[model samples]
Target: MTAIDWADYATGDKNAASRTLLMREFLRRAALWVDHLGGSERWPFFDIAERVDSSVRADPDLLERLDEFTNANVPEFIARRMCRAAVHWAELRESTEVTLPDLPDPYEPLIVLYERGGVFFVENGVADFEMRRVPLRTWQANLAPEPVVEIDQAVLDAANEEVH
Candidate 1:
């Protein structure tokens, strides 16, 4: 039997919690990168690396731009790489009779607390008719919430502009 090297198989961590925390940090960094890129109207994470890399190669003065672009697109690139590394690590660990700990996430209830508008906002709380005393007998006097499909960041931005 070949001697198993636990250190070689492990991805710098054997604790499932540490692995999860690392993944969460990666995703958080990715989100921040996307948000920063969005500020410059650079979004959708398509060919960002190539665009920035080629641009920087043509003009070295745009190194900062290249840095920001890579930082913004790190999530898309790093996630796949990390996943492959984790899988390879797990396979190696499994072969050495190392039992993987159960990563039980008992925070299902907490999900509602961290819910965002687009994903977790429930429409059930919205009423078909206005709750106010104003009566609408005609077709034009009706009040209803806009369809979800038509509501987006642009709509929100327009509403916010009026507030300021």
Candidate 2:
């Protein structure tokens, strides 16, 4: 499980501690949803994006906090992508004509969560390295060795004698 210092995101905004807590809870739920849906690669981001939009719309204060965090922590391009994704998700949900934008890559806790779960996010749906060309057998051959058990010789002899 990922441990977050809520204060880091809040940035000394003690007045909105409750909002910060709410955001933290929402993120925890979102992380759980990601795990349930098979990590970042297979994550149904459209659904989550819509939720993010709705949550933000419901609480302007939360939006303020989120914007602050995003500006401070997220890269400009990635923050723009996130905003676009929220708009795209809203369009899809409302059945508006879709203008397909580049999907937003996971950031922060999400990146760490998915990585820990053994799923990596590739930008533009393309891996930088030629992982596909590597043969399965070759990959298997490079796997770590299996575990070995150590048994005392005297214990083994005692067991054998008792069996006899």
Candidate 3:
């Protein structure tokens, strides 16, 4: 799929633009996770959890951005799991040597992102729903053309209102 020019909406509809930017960030991270795991294959949430943990260690502020993405209430289960995994992993990392944290309950189902004929689709762990597809030129296209700024909650709220 062609990359969205989020900047075009900047002046006309700031809220929508911000929301799209957020989704772009979420998808970008998902694509990276898939690449890190060595091609698109069904992956348990735990694997993603470990990656999330390491990512947080490298960039402390990533947790906050993940939190913001989760709070935006995206409909995809994978999105929620990604944020939840990050939180779970971070708590585990905080455990002291004397008192190790208990293992978190396992995440149900499995998610995967695969490519065919140069297009990508996400196999959302649910059987009832069909796989979700997003066409793009390449994995690198998932990255935003420019830096994505932090979106204000009020802007999200306004965008949600417009949608309703």
Reference-based TM-score of each model = 0.23, 0.28, 0.33
Per-residue lDDT of model 1, residues 1-164, tens digit only:
01212122222212222223222332233333333334324222122223223222223344445445434443334322332333333343334343333322112111211111101111342211112111212222221222211223344344434434
Full-model lDDT for every candidate: 0.27, 0.34, 0.38
Arranged by lDDT with the best first, the candidates are: 3, 2, 1
Deviation from truth (RMSD, Å), model 1: 22.6
Candidate 2 lDDT score at position 66: 57
1 versus 3: better lDDT goes to: 3
The residue pairs in collision within model 1 are none
Off by over 4 Å in 2: 1-16, 41-78, 96-164
lDDT of 1: 0.27
Q: What's the best-to-worst order under TM-score?
A: 3, 2, 1
> What's model 3's overall lDDT?
0.38
Q: Which candidate achieves the best TM-score against the true structure?
A: 3
